[model samples]
Target: MSVLDTAFVDTELSKKTSIFGLHLWVVIGIVVGAVIVLIPSNLFASLPRAAGAAARALPEIQIDMGKVEHRVVFSDRGASSGESRATSGAETGSFGDENVIGEGGYGIVYYGMLADNTKVAIKNLLNNRGQAEKEFKVEVEAIGRVRHKNLVRLLGYCVEGAYRMLVYEYIDNGNLDHLAYLHEGLEPKVVHRDIKSSNILLDRNWHPKLSDFGLAKLLNSERSYVTTRVMGTFGYVAPEYACTGMLNEKSDIYSFGILIMEIITGRAPVDYSRPPGEVNLIDWLKMMVGNRKSEEVVDPKLPERPASKALKRVILVALRCVDPDAQKRPKMGHVIHMLESEDLLSRDERRIARDSSSSLREEPSASRLEQQTKQ
Candidate 1:
């Protein structure tokens, strides 16, 4: 494990008030170049304590007052010498127009290469007064020590005067991976308030990484939900969260359900260009299922049709996720199990399958009889 550079720790700065009152030691140094290392999740569990008893908190980011530079601290245990990382003086980040890759409400992402030739996405946060600072803190504290194959990694951050930026592993494409990791894998569950398809990023090999934590909330073990202002993409918001602003893991499941439907059918959550009956994706999907037209709901552009049973199973999962009652939704882990199971048909789906087969067998004869009567 790479130790903290003691050279950056100043005696006078350690006496100052902790940044954000988190009992963090405000230091004098900032991270320079990128250090790419796949750290074990448990590596930070045994970090040495700081000056005070409250300073024993590990896996949490420490920020300074003036030039706020945040870094992820790791423990030496379980880390091999081959995985050693080196930290240096602050390196320059480029933001030329040619490097711009993506833009969002709060920041513009510019593609940059580190001194070690590692590609990274530099999130230049729009100087929106306190909003940028709040987002920076949330992201750093949230995923600073988080190491998951499906979640984007936060390398480091820089806060100098009015300018603020976050360094992230640059993902080539975007797609959903495992919400189960956030909802069940972590100690204090993380609720991704925004789980729309767009927030999910994919690498060159199509591995997905969940991105954007500006609206993410950490729910403690004591509480099941967090009451906050309703914030998310329009149409993707869970009904309960939208109506009452009470958010929980179920809210994310609901959004994931919408995302699943969006993928199955090549349609937006709400499409004004669609006919009146098909304006809302969920409502239209329910109508299609009610008419026994579930097979027709799959996107026509798919190169080959999915197996009947497989398609039905996916639809079942999606419907369960978007259930009107949030309590009825399946947990992320359960959803993963259902999706991966070979025999995925529920009792109701079995009955539907039988009915669909009967309908298919009778269709040609019924049409023939009608034609004979007309002749």
Candidate 2:
């Protein structure tokens, strides 16, 4: 599928309400109930995700729209008192169906405008059983103090009676990019439990920005890994993480591999609509590669085909990232090196990647594996 096709699928899917929303919606609910995690992104490290060359840091402003009591809880270097007023009046109107740009179990994301006409995405969280409240806290904690070129910016938040909302700098386009910063750049590694195509957004310039931190987990240096109940999207969750509930940066590397496959093939991680052999993306891709039919894996919709060597490098990198053994998966930094290098992988690395793909043929489906793990 092409970029256009992915957009169409998203449009059709989001319009229909099924369980929490669609695809791995139910799995996401499990993640919210448990402690979530995050991944990394280093694409365009010098280019900021927000607009303008002179990036301005925003404060976490808490607004009581009902009682007209508002205060800035966390202020950054670039934030100003006047800027707080700009976001205070953002939620003056109703968030009807027309304003909704996206939706999930957590809440509806609406396209709103500030007094200065700055475009923003307002997440109208559903505070059912306090899940939204918890999500809000996690999201804020994950990104409130950090600023990255590849991560979306949290402008502010609002609390009006039962209404809970988060304001974010609106990103118009939809795409994905490198995520090495979260794993290597930060002191306490941030592991994004849910790393899928939908969570990544793009700006007008087409620079990909990683979004949605409601399922992000922060891992300190003291602990090697955090063992919690299973969390994360079904097919994107790492097998070891799903089976043992041991989450670390490597689990994120596995999800990133799935995401790479999604971009290259324009296919969902798990799709039952396809033929039996082609239903599971990883299984199908592995079969194709194992049979030396790797050329057939690229999306047919791509206007121009990639050179064989370039394509081979991408496939090998993805296979390595998704290796069943988290220990075998390369670090995000090494993954980036593989992606950027114009040269092909060494023969040894190529054999390892190929073996990695072949090794998964006997394993159960990603969703089934995760479900069985949960059981």
Candidate 3:
């Protein structure tokens, strides 16, 4: 944990009073964030009481109070070379209105082009209750220095008082919540709590980009679980996270499992239109996989050939990810391995074995791993 300066703590806390008698925890969260900003990134592995308590809170950013500048520009680059198109909200009144790509709980995303004709998606956060500020800090903290082909780029940001905005490279298609395929890279794991299809966006070449960092949580390399409030789409949430507030990388695996089912079956996680017992994808898929009738749940529209080999493998991996017991679930590495394997059983071969089975089998989800002890 980074050390906190006692004098600095007294100075900042004295300046700001909790207007609404906000909970001590919330105030402490801010104090912790303030302290974190004064330290180095490598020291983030261990945070003191305040920071550890508020798992979702971001480290405080140093704003130049003297300038009182209407526009605040924060970028991944050391120094922004020219007038940025994203900071227009501070100078004028709008980010960009030419095209509205999408809108969500965080803010509205606009499609625009920069001076060099570089296309970008600018997010102007609705600074309603400081949610935008937290989102900006978290996104920058989680992904600012990290780069991956599968992840969306966090190009820049504008923190002009009440106006908090983010700039990202525009994705051609929508979020993964629109598309249904993607898994996290667990080595230095970043859990995208809300893993619905809409969060998955597609680029010009059709590669998926994962976006939205408001509800994201970064796990320290040495830690196995992060304790925090459970926030995510209802159907896509892992059972363990929903029941208990404990979350780890497996939580993402479970959501990915649900996503796979959605991709293959063309069904949402929760559909009341379906039969009573099978309303939840988790429950329905469990029944299908156990009955040795996994083939029954595939999307009818998926062409026959690839669906048999690739689709079955996809479903199998999805099932592994969604396994009710977090411990029983396979790691993302193992899941990917299975997905790419050629010799895995085909639908017909697996069905033959299922037909001869005398009794029902327990799947990872149905069997349920013993409740995990809080880490």
Candidate 4:
């Protein structure tokens, strides 16, 4: 209606138009920014799915024998055949010398070196083809998924048409049995069931490592509790498990307890040279322990002195481990703690007396000394 009002209206219209244009530019910038951020991610996310689908669609090739059909499982891209040694790099040899460290009734152990120079222990089945093959597969599958510091590591495997082998981390020191028995000149009183010094290996620092899973069963697992054919070394086998064929985790604990005792006393579970009354190391230890004399059970090579509390605690722990009833024995975790802790248990007086007797024996012979002095 008025000229001034008309001019003001036109200015307001121009401002509104400019504001709308700015808002539209802002919306466009946001859309462009989102596209820049999300496009690459979406493309990358779809790649794995697409590759997997392509793989699934590809025809699977199989080799047919008279009655057996074998499937080739692809491990890596560009791998021509599955027969290639699972080892990394191109280095190839029989590995017979490098891997073969020791032998036993069941298998032979070899020291294998990987491409990265990481050493591994390879156990090759010497006999029992079917059992070895099954064990190799079971171990690979079971150990691959399980991880623990105390347990040995499984690296890889080799199966060349009946030549079955398992690869594991290489321990520099031989098995625990050797240190406790052969080298120490002591007899192992423990029923390892499969007890031979070769089963236990030592690390570079001589820390004991338990190996040989071929016969190992997870004691806690229900599957392992089932009755099976009796198979184990005579000396290490628990009386109950050996006789009844009822093997459980306690069987392993019993064996471990015996091992601990052997480590402490430096005597075999069953020794032919020992007198008739002292044939069984466990029985002998029991008698000495019951009579309050532990020093008599200790290794002769060990120095004769007052029975330290440390020695008593170790003996107690060993006894607890070898309890006739598996239910009463402590778990490996507790055993490890008792071994490490100095204050957990106390020493017996008889042990001190035995130590004193040993000390007297070490002293010079009085008659011989007098004769030499006169001469």
Candidate 5:
């Protein structure tokens, strides 16, 4: 069994064994409960020294406290004497759905104002663990220095006691997690290791700006590929990257293909709500293509059916983008070319157009000797 399967089996078996040993467990539980009842209540209370030591053990990511103070406005409840606070008012600063911009793995991004009334998106990180702290620094150092028109700029950060937060320039339309946002042309060669719908954000002009650089890797002049631990959302990960941990721009291409299909179908990569055979997007797509029922793959909720030719081209491009072999996958620029070209879905058409093409060319089957011929 695979490691993941083994882990799952062991967990399920452990649960079943616990259930079967209920009587013995109950007896042991009673003794443990009696022993706990005899122990002092003070032991259960907060142990500040231990908590402090644990927090201090991890390498601290430096933050300019002066810059953070300008944007982070803590209320009386949020801050205490000798702590950072914007005001002495008992009410908390604006940070909610009413002013809520977006949400991600890190935390809720709130539309809020700085002391100078500058509009900002404040990400309130929910986790305070050491690993989470590293992610915080990763995001800050990764995108904080660079200024790009297509990327949401990280303005500053705040770290007070256990609370950690980041401030970003607010994008009015929010994110594409629900596949609800659509942005115009954005051509960046950067490989977003995690390219799910949620990581895309729409601006005031309906332009999509990619967000969440926490899992992103820059393919600079120095290097274009790396072999590391497989990391990313399941359905969007490339077959090559998932199997061998070999990552490059094509890995993101594979994920982008999945994202396009997500936009087309309004379906997530994996959904238990779907039928057994239709649970996975790629598997379902292949099944549909094999059955020549590709038309059925489009989301029924769409207001109007897209032209068959246009739709076919889209599906063809998506299929090519997700080809199993990493070498066969097209660059993002070429994928864009296919999307814009009409009647350019088939290999023959693309080949005639003088565009570079790759194939799923299968190997010939080995010949087996017939009984009569052998005799």
Candidate 6:
């Protein structure tokens, strides 16, 4: 009787122990499931705070459109009372007295460095009112929304009190005017009404970028003709526009044509030394295209003769852009297409002779990679 009673007690103890183990596992599973469900929400809840903290720890970057100024913290050190005025119209000492990179009618450019060691070009406007202000506002609006690789970017601006400043990405290669005339020894003849080489800036890879919008006019307006005070580089100005104060987009096209010709022949638009025959780029190109000696007109520096056809096509497109009749001139968009298309469009075929003689060559150089990025 005692042995049977002891056996029953042992059996009952084993069953209770098994039941306890099962209950323990069920409690653990519930706890783990609850934790898993709460984790993602907890992480998300903390994200904004983490981001705010990080932003606070970083140096402040402020753009003041009123003064045309860009202010950047030079160090992790807190701002002094004087530096605090930077929030207003005060110009900080961070930029100091940097050497002038370039100067134009409207502004002086200075090379600046941020606290984070980023290089930037600071353009301080000399003429703050009248057409300059209009141009500045238009440029700000136009460049702010558009992010194209080919176009120079407007990082920020300041338009405070009497001061106006524009900040832009620093380009290492300087301007195309340097390459087209100075370094290459080509006299630029085409009237760049606003010419003087500073308008054409070069990118990191040495590709040319057209800059300085103070004088550039939008062409597609209903007025069709821009009746403004005659202004531009003497050599680059179109004859009609120069003679009659009536400017059009074709004026730019003419200037660009002169620039292209300068790039090709390594001659300035008005080279006094080019004997009697080759003084003007337009006249020279007119002779080349008329005589069908298009291949003869190319920059000797460029490699691969196959690109000559493309170059000639570009030249012809430039001419069409500068057609004596403003009504006949192609729009910038069409001009861009004419320059870009390898095969002639149905409409372009009427304007340009297909240059099939030159086979398709390697892709455009990496220097022009930005142009592709815009597309």
Best by lDDT: 2
By TM-score, how accurate is candidate 4?
0.55
**lDDT of model 6 at residue 231?**
65
Most TM-score-accurate candidate: 2
User: How close to the true structure is residue 100 of candidate 5, measured as C-alpha lDDT?
Assistant: 64
Cα lDDT of model 5 by residue, 294-323, tens digit: 567777754445555555555656666677
Q: Model 5: runs farther than 4 Å from truth?
A: 1-101, 106-111, 124-139, 158-165, 176-189, 227-231, 240-246, 343-375
* Candidate 2: clashing residue pairs, number: 15
Task: Mark the 10 consecutive residues where model 5 has the least summed lDDT.
Answer: 363-372
Model 4 residue 235 lDDT score = 68
Per residue, candidate 2 scores C-alpha lDDT tens digits across 161-202 of 455566677887643332212334465676777676677666
Estimate the lDDT of model 6.
Answer: 0.46
Model 4 lDDT tens row, 11-37: 532231121121221112112211211
Please give each candidate's TM-score. Answer: 0.63, 0.66, 0.61, 0.55, 0.58, 0.52
**Tens digits of lDDT, candidate 6, 112-149:** 65556667677776645545545555545333323333
Q: Lowest-scoring 10 consecutive residues by lDDT in candidate 3?
A: 366-375
**TM-score, model 3 to reference:** 0.61
Residue 371 Cα positional deviation in candidate 1, in Å, after optimal superposition = 31
Better of 2 and 4 by lDDT: 2
Which of candidates 4 and 5 reaches a greater TM-score? 5
Return the lDDT, model 4, position 257.
Answer: 58
Flag the better candidate by TM-score, 3 or 6: 3
What lDDT, from 0 to 1, does candidate 1 have?
A: 0.55
**Candidate 2: stretches off by over 4 Å:** 1-93, 125-139, 158-164, 174-183, 227-231, 243-245, 347-375
Instruction: Name the TM-score of candidate 5.
Output: 0.58
lDDT of 2: 0.58
Better of 1 and 3 by TM-score: 1
